[model samples]
Target: MIVQHNIMALNSYNRLGTNNNAVQKNLEKLSSGYRINRAGDDAAGLAISEKMRAQITGLERAQLNAKDGISLVQTAEGALTEVHSMLNRLVELGVESANGIYQATDRDKIQAEVNQITEEIDRISKSTNFNGIKLLDGSLGSSTANVDGGSAITATQTDATQAQYVGANAVLNGVTFASLTKGDVLTVTVNTRINGTDSAQTFSLTYNPDKHTQLSDLQDALNAQIKEAFGADFKVTDNTQVLTFEAKEAGADKAIVSGMSWTVKNYNDSASGVVVATGSTSMTETKGVDAYTTVSGFDGGATALTKTSSSADVEKNTLTINGQKFVMVKDKDAAANVNKIDSGINVIVAKDLDQAAADIEKATGIKVAVDGNNLKVFAPKGAASGGAGLTLQVGDTADSFNKVTVSVDNMSSAGLGVNGLTVTDQGIAADSITRVKSAIEKVSVNRGRLGALQNRLEHTLNNLATTTENMTNAESRIRDTDMAQEMMAFTKNNVLVQAAQSMLAQANQQPQQVLQLLR
Candidate 1:
């Protein structure tokens, strides 16, 4: 045996080192409670676990985002509840005023209350917020169609006209009353000016052929009835087989006749009445339009022109912009009609093209200017700030349905259709009633939408939680060490290390044996 070259000892020494290294590795796995403590231990497993960790973190954050979304929906819905209540109150007032029992003074008091409610509604819409973000100002998602800007339009009232006629008076007007028998009832509605505002009153007359066979008797009966009911002097005159009713006073403020209607009821056969000539008239009070200019470098710009007396001619006008259509209708408080587009854009009717351009700018963030009888609309310069609509990201992934967009519209009195409600007379009050009801419906719809979104977010949160739990479990399987199994491995490695040490000592002794032989 050569002292310098001891092959057996060398082999045993290498085995000892190998076993010692394995023992340390097993110790690490047990102490750390992870199958792969480092990349050197399991490179592929580390990569996979890290990916799972990222997904888990993302899911956690997404859940938080969903919670925030629910909070926002709740905030908006709460404000809308108040709006709903106000609309109900407005409807109540409207119905009361339409009964014609209240005088002009009483109606005015009711109108004041309505106006206050409207203003409050507008205030709530403008101020309602979640985390300082306006909720009901149509910033979420908005669409628009053909619409342009114009001056502020005022309210207009239609001219008075004779709507119906009955009795022997009908015969004088070349129409025969075939069923003017006993117990026949005739209803007459008179629209007149009272206290500088429009008012209406109705009178019912029961026909008794035995008591009212002569035309003179019929005229006297009608005169006495009119004087008592309306507190006004009026005479019905006949000229060449034609009948005309005129107020005794003569002047603009002399309770001029606005409209007249008559209806026959409780007749054996069909009652006959003739409608006199229809009257069409309107009065406008102008509020100047605000102007708007276009931002440079805007594509898809549009031009709008304002038309005079002819401008208010259209009962309803439609505008198509960016594949969206906006319908414009006359507003009592505006000089021209206005349209609220689904895209959060507003179209204002103006007296002229310049006024339209101005009004458009004031209403929409978009800028516009008159381009020869046409108003041009353009996007504002720089990124849309302040007025940019709401954007909600609901998922970690960039996919459809992961994002929700909503356009919260203005919820003010004007937006709710009660901005210019008037209760001066039965006709006007009746119109107000219809408008108030419509506002109530709008508020209901908005509330429903918000509630639905809240529910969807709740479901989203649950899904995220489940996904996180399952993924965490998968990650644990890949990364966590089974303590019992690791302990067994550690014990086996410990025994092998001791055995290798003992063998190492024996192998070193063999090298000493060579020295003994040399001695």
Candidate 2:
């Protein structure tokens, strides 16, 4: 009775449209098989999964990087192996040289080979590289130790006597002396002469002050004339009244006196026995008082004179700093012999003596030893005397270098000297090779650690894959529509739509009864 519009058909169409949309969504879910097809499907889950995906990818790549590091270390180790082989061969050559069987010529040939091997070492040090980074060359690394700190870094050379061979000059004055004059003879009348030793040579001298300007001046002139004549072989002595001349050289009998106005008494005698005027004096007592190399004579005993050599009055190497030369000692044991370094520097003591020694050598070209609580730095006896200037700095302390720490671990057994890879007849060369190998091993072990970390990453990746699968499945249950249930609903909705259309047609037909009333 209150039929205003076909509201039942309108309601049926609206319900069918809604059920169709649901069915279509279920079908899409079945086809795609993922809960989140886009950001609209699940916002928070998509964001978290994306982050996890990036981490998994980075971990995989990191593992590859670690593997590459291992390869580089292995390559360097292989090259070092070849160097070790060549070193062993050089050691064999050194042994052959030391046998004393080889002549000078054979040794020369061996030296040539040694030179070639040294060239090879230089070549390897320069040419070896990894990723454009040189590995065996000492130039590759920056010094971690700071030399400018408050601690003094020093180096010492070992041999003190090698300076003589290097043309070091002596402090020279104009004065010189003759070692001996041969003319005077005191006949041994009390001691009977042997069968063939009765011959002698004789000479005499009379000192006149009017003939020479001063006695001291005459003595200098006489000393120089004598030394120029006999070099270091002859000796002279004066007893204030008469001057005696003698020779210590075998079969030496005569001397010509120079720069003196004197007459000979008995110039002629048998030459079977000779006399020498060798004079001796205490050199230490005459230091700074008399000119060096002055000789005085005793009445009748063996006389000694200072043998003239460049070493007799040599000065120490002049070390200059800040435009001033530091006072140095010819011998390190003399009074106040230490070279006074003026600059203040911070000291970063290394963990052990060996490391400290190496640092000092690198910084100052001098080796150092830990003496009790102090450091004793010595130049290798004859190291050439030039060094990079040291700057006193206090800012940055070396964090990598440890301060004087002693542990009970075994020594590294590696060095560049007798025990190292430069193998003469000594095992030092082998020791250096061993140390290098050990270093290589340490790098290799570090690479192994990286490899282990890479393995862990791989395991994590696998776990992430399994977790991703499970999580995706769980999300699917929450967001996906079931294809079986949706298909049934779609089919039922289609049937209901057709049945509603039929019932609506029948209801509309009932409204056409006015035509039957007109008939």
Candidate 3:
């Protein structure tokens, strides 16, 4: 009706533009084979999909890690198989030497073989390695000490408890240490003993998304802040994606990480690292160690120590030292509970407590139970093995619940207490056989532990496969395009696009017809 404002044509043009946009969106979804390619398509779905994708990736990597752990266990167990054979052979030689018919000269040859076999045992324990990591040594296994039953000739067993004076330590694995993002600010409150006085200090670090994107970036930055605030005696380390803090000086009440709290703006924001720890997260810190509370012997009895004194007649406490003939002298009011003497041999006393081989607990049964209230210490208890050092990360989570740890006992000749055994004499040779049998039991126990580790890993692999499949299925449902459905949508939108184009053309013509009014 009016030349100045072509209202009909404007309506067609607007409809055409809107229809074309729908067509473009349809093409994007169809060609890309994705239901939601951008945030505009489905913002909530995108976020959920991304988080699921990350979990899948982590689960996959965890499978590989579990595989590596199996390999390590296999290598250690296989080497132990050989050790088992050598130990059995040692027992055979010992029994042969024990025969009364065998003369001293013949027994010497047996002794020579025993020495070589023992040396070879030591060699295997020292040199056995898997990927440059020692397997049969005391390092990878839990620490065990020989619990002597009072006398040198008594039965000995392995005990795995230690005093909690190693260090104040803990791993804050609850937080996905990689997740700290830009504008994410966290404060660490540290409580420590300064000159035996309890002191508290707080330090905070802010994450800049522009700078820290790598896992190491987050760890290093946070660690630096912790170190600066915690001072020189403490050290922070990241192991297997775990943040561990330990004191360089070993003792009770050394350090305590009182609390850790964070404030994050976005889940991932600008940080390249995936944000895992979410929502006002905090870790409750506990003290790591305890002082000299109660000491129990290896045999579930009271602990005893033999002190060698310059003055022999110091109150005459008759305590036998390793079955060696020694006179025990009382130096104090304290006395041991168990009496293990032919007559009246009392346990030794101190003041006269000069000292012996600091035994590293080889000749003593020193049990230290931790009192959690006193100090911050992390004392790893020893086990049937000499040390438990290897930790297996079998799950995607960074917590103790998701880990499997194994103990590889030391299988060396000395470790089994056969290094000193001799096959040259009949009585001694018989004793050697007894000891070798004991050694065999130790190797068997070690192998059994490794076997358990392998089996557990196998089960873990099965679980991981199942979980990965399920998660992938869930993510696909939320993300992947339904091709048939998309096709139907595409067809409908394409038709609308064509219709809009034709209408737009007609709209232009309608404006032209208005000019014919001038004619």
Candidate 4:
């Protein structure tokens, strides 16, 4: 009966507030369509949902990255396709030039086309880019050169001497100099072997009947031409009636004159100037070059170059030159093995000291000449002084994403092993055919690698998509609210709130009874 203490009304009011708060929460959830809109709604669910959302977003981004990777690969492959076609055409041209029916002028025309194609290949290699990133340039792959630790040899020089003829009565190689006229041109083709391959250079000497052109004058002119074309690689010397041409640098790698032929064109009295000596007949192989090292310096027998170790320590014993590492290994036969060098370079450690020296010279483009039991090693002529070798590193981790790296090598003519290709003569053309074939194989292999990378990226993209979809679904389950269920809850809470308000009113009326008693 106390009007001051309305406990029943107070309880009804508290219950009304609870029902109203519940109804408000239901309305919020229904409007937002999220069960866990904030941390207070569902702390544990919110945490899990946020983690899933992060994963979904990451997966989506990763898929995009993979697609980009695919596009890059496709771009590279397309460029290589053109390269493949051009290589095929080059092969055809090389074969065409090999026939005997084609004259020197015709061969020259074909060579011009070949040169143009080579330039085009280089242009493509330099220009082909994916998003401004060079694709076919040699920067992507490891440029490595393996040096052999065989018997170091000194430089050797082979000389070709020509007997000089001066007076009208004198004859050289069955050809009288008196028969030559002022306008007569002697075309000399010098064939040189570089890196186990033959390359030729043609030079013309114009005979002047007015100047009385001695053999010394001709020698000086030829030497100047050689110096200009080869950059100090060869020289010519003349004494009295003897004229000699020699490679400036000693060793097997030196550009030695393999063959030389001279044809007197537009000459007066062709029968009188018929040159007899031809095709390296005037050249003689000389021995006894200066040796820089003794046979005792090597580990194996004094005569043979052998490995010090029983097995190859590819990880340990390595020489890094020009950012490229050259690995030396021991063969099973206890011989010093240099087989790991590039296939283009033939470095074999043979029992014969001369053969071993030759092999080293051919492989490294360096001169190796034997001095008795000792061997001497000299750099190739015109080689850059203090030039560092190439370098290659494995397992580099500088990229942004975790991925397996694919190495794409240089796609230029030199990189493809077609540099300095000669399709002029039948012999040279035959050799060039083999070289072009090898180039084609290299391109094919590179294209195959690109295709493989593209396929792998496609798979990665698919996987990323699946992971993103699944994670998104999981996040939706944790965060999204069922509108239908929430609406039902809202209806129930609204009814409860209304009932609480009515009960609160009735409870207040009960307090009015005490007032009535007082009246």
Candidate 5:
């Protein structure tokens, strides 16, 4: 018997402490309603659960984001609905004016109504707000383009091809105007003239005169002697033996009014009846009238005059005036004229209004109207209303409407309205209404798509909830302790502990028996 070592007691105590720890852990699992409360409980389960929880939270938030997206789309669609309605009303008005029988006054009254609706459209485009952001009027789009002279201009166009010219003279005479073409349209105009006295009367050529060969080509030129005497400004052209000089710029009187005049003998056809002189005295006539100045008919048999003297009539030679005989005239004027007023409802798509306006002006040769969201430009007047001015529908992207055509004037010869307007044959308002209806349909389709997605998300959320519950149950089976089973084990261990104590006492009695021998 070694009193130094209490081996049995130590063994029993260690076993008790370990059993108590097991009991405590089971109790914790049952009470906490979780399989893994701490990393020590089930490190792998804890890690897996944490990741699942994060994903669940993120999925919920994603669902919320999708809902918000739908709302935005719906808001835009509703605004467009109103826009469509307005367009329908305008279509009806267009039909009312299609009847040619209506006088201008009647048209003006209808125009007033049209103008009012236009104003309303502008108001809507400017005022429609979605979560503090504008939706329908293209407010949230922009792009930057650089032009010459170290300047940058930002612009937006429904057509990607539309470009903004930031600098001066970026394009001259319609060639590649910029170092980077970037799909910009350029129109160039050149103003030049022909001089006669300096050389000979000459005609400038074009690429295809066969098509427009008969077009007039008259220009101003300087006379060799008078050009040197008076300097660069003394330019002249002749009409039937009469000479007229033009100044660099128009003033009180052209130079011919104050300059001396003479006629070479052979050049004056008055000597022959080939030409007649009515308003002159000698071989030369100097009424000092400018060319193409609308002149009234002759006063009583005093007919329109022509040069009548020709000094070298007997000799045959190529006719020359100021050196040469023929002068080519080219007409430089506006191609056509038609005025259009748009509400400029799409300014939001542009980086800046001024640059956008400038681009439209340059490309279309029309004045841009920036009064509101409606972009308006004067149409080529006399444009066959049929193929001329079409209001383009801008698509979702910046380039959607680039190629869309707008030919309002050419809607129909006989028209009540294109879509559903009540006008005579040939009204454009109806067609515009049709277009708006199409847009509405598109918006409706998109909304339907959102609705479907929302349904899917709801279903997904339900499935995720069910899966999370089942997964928790499975983990519990592996890591949780049943309280009833743990209580039964604790009761058994308690009985054992008491029995062991009793046995230990009995063993002590046995040791006392040995003590009797010592007595």
Candidate 6:
């Protein structure tokens, strides 16, 4: 044996070091309870596990977000419940005022209560919030105005007349009513052109069976209403129980005839008054037009022209994009309004628009898209911030598909039209009753919308919880150390380390004996 180097001892010494390293690694994995403790352990697994851990964390946070969204919806809905109660109280007071037995002072007292209730409604709408984010107060509302409302707007426009309804304007057609009945209410629409624009004037004749039993009686009553409304310019005749209007002007086309259209309504169910429908053309042959309101000032000190009221057209909300000006019009009554819109100058107050931008582009060729926001420029719902509207992040990533958008309109007194309700007079009190009823409906509808949002968030939360649980399980499979398998490996390595140490000592002794032999 050579004293310079003991080859056997060297091999055993190297084996000891290898076994000790194995034991250390095994202990570490056991202590840490992770198969991928470091990059060296499992490079691919470490990367995958880390990514999955992030996803799990994100899912957990998303669940919390959904819960928060639900809480926000609840807060708004709860405030609306109080508003509903106040509206009901207003309805009660209005009904009481209608009783002629109540003196003017009593009516005054009812009006005071109404004013207070309206003020309280305004307070609740402005103050209701979740984590400092306003829920109602119109701050969270989309740019779309609910002037006519969704219920008023049809989801699908089937025909040209339906299309007219969509735009809230249509060409008036002349109609001769046939098969007149006792309970028929006829609407006489006359649209006269001034400066190439049709100004519409309408009068309605409600037929009572006791008063207007004959076709002549109905015809004469319409004549009387028209004479007062239209200046005795058109002549009406009931030939074989059919009413038609003729213009006194010599050069006017009989087709136009000032566009007199009679819409028949059978208010009484028992009374059979089926009016035959007839169609004619207007002087300009005007069609229906689309209307829209603009919200602008979306960038670097750009002034935002936000709509102050849904119904009130007093405030003009103009959007100037790329130097193209959009003007808000109160009256979308003319069919030329669509053509006016294409010129990029005419903007009208949109009413009863469900698909705010979609419907306008379909029937009318008006592209109603604006970018950016100002202080009043709220982000549109489901869209990224920089505009007005609330977006809830319900997903792990920045993908827009992972977010939820919420829209809540202003529920103030003026917003609901209950602010101007007065019961100081019987006739006004009777009108106030109708206004309060409408306000109650608005509150109920708002509550329903909030409830729907709460339900959606609840569903989102459940989905997140399930997704997080599954993802965590997958991550655990990849990253967690299996106790039984790891413990067995540890035991085997520990034994090998001890055996290596003993063998290393034996091999070193062999070298020591070489020195003894030399001596």
RMSD of each: 24.0, 29.5, 17.9, 24.0, 24.0, 20.9
lDDT of 1: 0.53
- Looking at model 6, residue 429 earns an lDDT score of 76
Tens digits of per-residue lDDT, candidate 1, 1-519, equal 667877777887888888889888888888888898889988999999999999888888888888998888888999999889888998899899889678899988998898788778868877888889888754442321111111111111221121121111111111223433454333333333222243444444454445423555444555666566655566677554334544465344433333322212122222222111112122111111121121111111112212312232222232322212222323323322222112222344444555655544443324556555333443222111112356667666778677766555546554454654666556657766877787788778778888887888899899989999999999999999988888888888788878878887877788676566667
lDDT of candidate 3 over 191-300, digit per residue (tens): 32222233444444455556546655555555555555554343555444344444454344542222222112122223354322322223212111111111111121
Query: Clashes per prediction?
Result: 34, 50, 17, 15, 55, 8
Q: How does candidate 3 score on lDDT? A: 0.54
Give lDDT: candidate 2, residue 441: 50
lDDT of model 2, residue 206: 25
Q: Give the per-residue Cα lDDT of candidate 5 at 140.
A: 27
- In angstroms, the error of model 5 at 396 is 28
Model 6 scores worst on lDDT over the 10 consecutive residues at 149-158
Q: Of models 1 and 2, which has the larger lDDT?
A: 1
- Candidate 4, 389-499: lDDT as tens digits: 112111113343546455566677656756546676665676678778888998898899889988877777777777777878889988999888898899999999999
lDDT over C-alpha atoms for residue 28 of model 3: 86
Error of 5 at 429 (Å): 5.8
Clashing pairs in 6: 298-373, 377-388, 378-387, 378-388, 379-387, 379-388, 379-389, 382-405
Cα-based TM-score, every candidate: 0.55, 0.37, 0.57, 0.54, 0.41, 0.56
Q: Model 2, which residues run further than 4 Å from truth? A: 1-4, 94-96, 111-118, 121-519
Model 2, span 24-94: residue lDDT tens: 65556667755566887679877776665555454444445434544544555555566555556565666
Q: Which stretches of candidate 1 lie over 4 Å from their true place?
A: 145-389, 515-519
Distance from true position, residue 262, model 6, in Å?
26
